[model samples]
Structures are given as structure tokens and as C-alpha cells.
Target: MDESYYKYHLFFCVNTRSDGGPCCGDSSAPQLRDYAKQRIGELGDAIPGNVRVNTAGCMNRCAEGPVLVIYPEAVWYRYQNRADIDEIITEHLCNGRPVSRLRI
Candidate 1:
């Protein structure tokens, strides 16, 4: 297989369940997405180039809401706060190691 264009593609699920169902948005995923983006930007060359972070819709795992999935490995994770985001960025995106504790 050809090399990936991006080293890592991280998708933060930000789906909002209007029916009061569990969702990543219920845990402030949108804001966390923004935080990850801003933090990645701030890290600059500290983080490898070609790592993409984005917000996604329902991943059909709302029961495990506040989740993110990282590709090309397709590792899914559940996170709570900024610290978790930082750990994901540092351990996964920066160092090529997925944060096992956060994995769902």
C-alpha cells in the first residue's frame, strides 16, 4: 500500500443528540475539538506535519460518547477533558503511540 498523505487522521465525534441521548457533544466535544486543533497548531513543528484533526458526526457509538478515532490505525478512544486531549496529542499524534488508557 502507498504511504498515507497524512501521518495521522484524528476525528473527534461531536454529534449532538437532541433527544437527550448520550453524545460526544454532551461532553463538550466541539470545544475539545477546537482545543485539539488549537493545541496542535500551537505545537507547530513539535508535532509532525501532515497530522489532521477534525470533528465527525455520530460514529454510532454514542453509548461511548466523547470519543475519537485515529486513522490510519483506526483506533477509537474516549476522552474526558483537556488532559486527555493532550495525552492523545503527545502520545499518539506526536510519538506515534496510541493512548491505550483512552482507547474504547
Candidate 2:
């Protein structure tokens, strides 16, 4: 099989609903997404292949706001804070192991 374009492509949903509704942006997805990007930048070559963290519009999983999806594997995860972001980076992105507890 061919290698993935980016070993891990992370898409963080940062959409905020017009009316009152649960949304990733309202749940701090942007901030956490930035944090994840910074952390990955710091990791540099320590991580395999190229990892791209991007901001995405609504994934329609509003009830599960603050959601992030990793490509190639298409693993979805819901995170609360920086610590959870750290866990994802360390375990999944770095170690090639998905964090079962965070899977959504």
C-alpha cells in the first residue's frame, strides 16, 4: 500500500452555530487546535511523516462538540482540555496507538 499523504491529518471542528446550540468553537476547539499545532511543531522530526492540524467547519456532530478527527485511520475523538490534547498527541500521533478512552 502507499503511504498516507500526511501520516496523521487532524481536523478540529471549530464551527459555532448561529442559534443556541452545542458547537465545537463554543467548546474551545480553536484554542485546543492551536495548542495541538504548537505541540506538533515542537515535536518536529520526533513524529513520523507530516502531521497537519487544520481547522474545519461543522462536522454535524454538535452534540459531540470539540471533536477532532485523525485521517488515514479516520479516528474520531472528543477532547476537553490541553491535557487531553497532549494525550492524543503522545499516544496516537507519536506512538501510532489510538487512545481508546478518547475515541468517540
Candidate 3:
């Protein structure tokens, strides 16, 4: 991998349940993940391989629900919808500053 990149990676937990436990996909994991991936793709292409966005199993933070983690920076976030995901991508991933309002 190229060292010019900041080595940032974001992982979204997409756990689901029939019994109703807290999960990232519980509210809108698929939508969020899709949005995240698409937004990252849109944003990262400008930088060309600086960040990686991915799907995860549980992230062991189900209690927090709708959780996502960014590595190297190790920032954790809880989001409600596509708008939040978009903000994260625009304000944090693209700008090098974390979205403090959404951090969890």
C-alpha cells in the first residue's frame, strides 16, 4: 500500500436478529452501509485509495447499535440515517476531521 495515504479504514457492523437485539442494521444497516460504501467510493476516488470502507459482523458494540469504526484514527460512531453517514464521509473522511457530534 502507498504510504502517502493516511491508512484510514472504516467498518460498519451489520448484525441482525429475529429476537430484537440492538444491531447496526436494526434501523437501517443496509442503507447505511450502502450509502457509506457509495459515499466512500465517491469520496475516495478523488484521493485514489486513501481509505477503505467495509462491512463487519457485530463489532461487539450492539448495545450502542448502528455502530461504525474508523481505524488508524480509531474513531467510533453511531448513526441514524443516510444523512449522518453522508456527514461522516464529507466532514470526517474527506476533511481529516472527525464528526464530533456523531462520535460514540
Candidate 4:
């Protein structure tokens, strides 16, 4: 068996909007997910066997828009941009503390 370091897995809800209702697509889900992946790699913590950034179909929190859920802990977040994603990566992913300001 291979060893893994990351204790958390994050998933962004990139569900699209077709009915003109609210959804992650209407916000910054794509950007956030991309930013997260990049940041993780840049931090040298993006081991495919440990941490993974994935796109989810729907988290059922469309109203929140740009929703991301961290697993192995299952913390949901609502973000607005790169800064929020950064905070999550730094505070939550790296430091093991959830960013209460962005919790959803």
C-alpha cells in the first residue's frame, strides 16, 4: 500500500444552470476550483494519491453558489474569488482549521 499525506479531499460543485436559477456556474466555481488545484500544486501538496480537487455535479446548495465541500471532514464553503480559495487552502487544507468566515 502507498502512503498518503493529505487528510482532506475537496470538491467543488460546478453544476450548470439551465433554468435561470441559482447555481455554482452562476458564481466563481470554475475559477475557484482551478485556483485551488494550482495553489495545491504550487504548495507541493497536490499529491494525486493524497489530495485531489474535483468537480461535483451538484451539492444541492445552489443558492449558496460557488459551493465547495472538503471531505474526510465534510466542511462546506461558499466563496467569491481567488482570495477565498486561498484562505481555504491556507487555513483549512494546510493548517487544518476551517475558515469560519467562508463557511456555508
Error of 4 at 95 (Å): 0.7
* TM-scores of the candidates in the order shown: 0.92, 0.95, 0.82, 0.87
Q: What is the C-alpha RMSD of each candidate to the true structure, in Å?
A: 1.4, 1.3, 2.5, 2.8
Give the residue spans of candidate 2 off by over 4 A: none
* Residue lDDT tens for model 1, 36-101: 999998998888868788888899999987999999899999998999999999998889898889
What is residue 4's positional error in candidate 1, in angstroms? Answer: 2.4
Better of 3 and 4 by lDDT: 4
- Candidate 2, residues 1-104, lDDT tens digits: the string is 67767889999999998898988888878989999999999999888899999999999888977899999898999999999999999999889999999999
User: Regarding lDDT, does 1 or 4 come out ahead?
Assistant: 1
Instruction: Choose 2 or 3, whichever is better by TM-score.
Output: 2
- Tell me how far the alpha carbon of residue 60 in candidate 2 is from the true structure, in angstroms, after superposition: 1.2
Off by over 4 Å in 1: none
Give the distance in Å from residue 97's predicted Cα in candidate 1 to where it truly belongs: 1.3
Candidate 3 lDDT over 27-102, as tens digits, reads 7887788888877777655543477778888788888878999887789998988889888887777677899999
- Over 27-94, each residue of candidate 4 has an lDDT whose tens digit, in order, gives 77887788888888898743334688888998789888788899878899999988888888888877
Clashing pairs in 4: none
Question: Which stretches of candidate 3 lie above 4 Å from their native place?
Answer: 1-6, 45-49
Clash pairs for candidate 1: none
Q: Rank the candidates by lDDT, best first.
A: 2, 1, 4, 3
